[model samples]
Target: MKQLLLVFTILFSPSFSAQKTETFKIKKYQIAILGDSLKESSGLNFFNGKLYTFNDSGNSAELFQISLDSAKIQKKLNTKLRNEDWESLTNDGENFYIGDFGNNLGSRKDLKIYKIPFRDSLVLDSTKTISFYYPEQKDFTPKNLNNDFDGEAMIFLNGKIHIFTKEWKSKETTHYIINPENFENQAAEKIETFKTDFVVTDASYFEDKLYLIGYTKLAKVYLIVFKKSENDTFFRETPKKYYLGSAFSLSQIEGIAVNKDGIYISGEEFHSPLGIKKGQFFFIPFSDFD
Candidate 1:
C-alpha cells in the first residue's frame, strides 16, 4: 500500500507531472501610424472598435475618429469646447471627458474639463463643459527636478473622476479623486501615489489594470503596469523595467490607452535639433502582450 501511494503521489505532483510550465513572455508590437502632424497628440480612447484622439494645443480643438484596422481617419468632429491647453481625454460609457487642465506655468487657477456626448454626428454646439479647481496649497514653485504638477490624463471610474498628473520633471505620480457630479469647486482628494523610473505622461485602465507610459530623459519610452489592491489603491505589479521603445522618431511620448484590441501610444515631439514633426499616434496589437 505504501509503494502504491508513493507512485500515485509522484504521478500527480505538479513538479513531477508532465504538465507544461507556462511562462509569461513580453511581446513586441508593430507600430501602425494613425496620423502625422497631430500638433501634440495628447489623448486617446476607443469606442465600438474605432479610435478617437485629440490635439493638446491648438485652435478649434477637433476630435478625430479613426479606423483601427486601416489606420485611417474616418471623421473629424469639431468640439464646442475651446482648447485652452487641452491635455488628456477619456470616456465613461456614454460621454467623452476632455481635460483642459494643462497648467504648465503653475499660475493658473481656473482649470476645467469638457464632457461631450458620444454620437456619430456630434456638432460643436452640442457639447457640454464642466470646470474644476484644486484647493490652494501654499503656491510654491517646483524646486526639485520632480515638481512640475499639471496633467492631461483624466479617467472616469466607478462614478468618480480620477486624475493623474503629467510630471514634467518628476519620477513619482500623484492620484486624485473628484466628484463628477459636482464639477465646480471639486476639491481633489489625494488618494495615493506611485514612483516610477520614467516620467509618466498619460495612462489608461484596461483588463482590471492601469498602464502608464512615459519617456525618460534618455529618450526611451517605457510601459509600467499597476494592479489595484483591495483597499482601492493601485500598486506596481510589473517587473522592474520594460521598454516599449521610442514613439516614432520623437522622444516625448505622452498618451496611452489599452482595450481588448491592444495598446496605443502617442507622442509630443521632444526637443530636437533637426526640427521633427510635432505629434503622432502609434499602436501595438494586444496579442503582443499575451
Candidate 2:
C-alpha cells in the first residue's frame, strides 16, 4: 500500500510540493476503554462545559455526552436527522456543526453538513443544512478509496466552515472553504494542500492552534499541531508532528478534540490480525508533549 511509503511519499509527492517530515513518539498518555454504546465514536467535541461524541454511519441520529473524567456516556441528545456518515464534530462558540460528509468510496455527490442549534447546553432538533460540492470533482466515478474528494474533518472558522480532505491515494489533505452566509448549494473552494502522509479523520481548533489527527493505511497513527500563521492561515507553516503509536495497538484511532486542559482522542471498534479489538479513548495533557 502507498501508506507503507509515507517517508518517501512526503518528500516526492507529485501532486503537491514535497517537504520533509520527522515524527516523534508521544510517550505519556491515559487510555480508557469506552462502552459498546460509543463503540463507533467517530467524532469528539466539547459543548458548553460537557464533552460530546456520536457514532458514525448506519447508527442512530443521537449525540452522546461523554464524561471527561471517565470517558463514559452521560447523556443522549436525540434528533430526527439521518446519520449518513457523521465524521467530525465542532462548534463555533454558539452552534455545533456535524460534518456528515464521509466519502470513503469518493463517489458521493450528496455531501452536506448539519448545523444544529445548541442552546442551554442542549442540541435542538431544528437544524440547518449546509450543502456543498467540490468544484474539481467533475467525475462521479466510484473509485473506492482512490478519490481525492473524500473528507472527514472540518471546523467553523472566520465565519466560514473549513473542511480538510482525507486523500486516500496521495496521503495529503486539502483545505476547502464553505461560506455559511451563502445558504443555497455552494461550491467548496479548495484553498491549499499539505502532504501529511496520512488520511486525516478528524480535526479540532482551539486557542489559535489547529490539531489534526489521522492514521495511515498501514495503521500508523499521527497527531499534527499546526500553529496559526501570521496571515490568519491554518496550514501555511510546518506543524509539530508526533507518532502516537499504531492503530493496531490502539484500535482504529479516529476522533480528536482539544481545549485548555489537554487533548482527547477517540477510536472506533476495530478488529485486527492481532485478535485484539475495542474502541479507545486517550487523554494527553499539554505538558507531556512539551
Candidate 3:
C-alpha cells in the first residue's frame, strides 16, 4: 500500500502544482503618457462613456477625465473634500464612491468612503461619508508597513461594497463586504481570503468578472481575474493570474478598469535602483486574454 501511495503522490503532485503556478505573459497593446497632472493616479474607472482616475495620498483631492484618443487630461474636477489617502474608486450608475481607507500601518481608525452624486453633476461640493472598521481586526496599535489591514482595491456590487486588503506581511488579500447605505460607524464583514503574494492596488467588476491589478515589492506587474461562482461569490474558486511583465516595462501599475472594448490600466511613476518610469496608461485588448 505504501509503494502504491508513493507512486500516486509523485504522479499527481506536479500536475496539481502546475495548475496553481500557471501564469501567462501579457504585453501592453497601447501605451500613452498621462502627463504630470496625474502623476499619482491610483484609481481607474469608466463612467458616462469617459475614462476617469484620481490621485492617491498626498496629492490633489480632484478626479481627472482622460481622453483615450488624445491620451491626455480632458478635465480635472475638484471634489472639495479631503484627499486623506484616497486609493480606489467605484460607481454604481447613479453615484460614485471614493475609498479613503489606505491603512498602510494597520493603525488607522479613520477609514472612510465618500459617496458623491456624480451622475447628476461633474463637480461635487459635498458628499455622504461612510465610516467603517474591519470586524476581524482587534489591534488598534500601529503595525507600520507590516500590517495587513492596508487596502487599496474596492468595487461596488449588488448594493454592497466589496473591499480587498493588501496584506503586507502575508501577501494575502482578505475580502470584506460593507453596506453602502450605512453612514454611521459600522463593522465590515469578513468573507474570504486569497493568497495573491502581491499588493493589490485596484479592482474592477464588469460582466460577472472581477479584475484586479497589483505589483510585487520588486515591481513585477500582475493581473488577477476571477469568475463569479453560480451563487455569485469569488470565494468559491481560485482566481487565475497573468504576469503582465515587469513594472519597468509597464510602469508601477496601480489602477485597472475593464469595459467591452478592453482593459484600461494606469500606473504611477516609480523611482528605484532598477530605473525610473513615468506615470502612464496602458490598454490590453480582450483578444489577449479572451
CA lDDT of every candidate: 0.63, 0.80, 0.79
Count backbone clashes in candidate 1.
1
Residue-level lDDT of model 2, residues 102-197, one tens digit each, is: 888888888998888887545565678889999988888898778888898988788888899999878889989888666688999888888888
* RMSD in Å for all candidates: 14.3, 4.4, 8.9
Pairs of residues clashing in candidate 1: 88-152
Local distance difference test, candidate 3: 0.79
Cα lDDT tens digits for candidate 1, 158-225 = 88778876554545667877776674666778777666655566778886677777655444567677
Model 3 error, position 180 (Å): 0.9
lDDT of 1 at 203: 76
**Best candidate (score: lDDT):** 2
In model 3, the number of clashes is: 0
Sliding window of 10 residues with minimal summed lDDT for model 1: 1-10
TM-score of each: 0.79, 0.89, 0.89
Ranking by lDDT: 2, 3, 1
**Candidate 1 Cα misplacement greater than 4 A, ranges:** 1-30, 33-37, 123-126, 140-146, 236-241, 247-251, 274-280
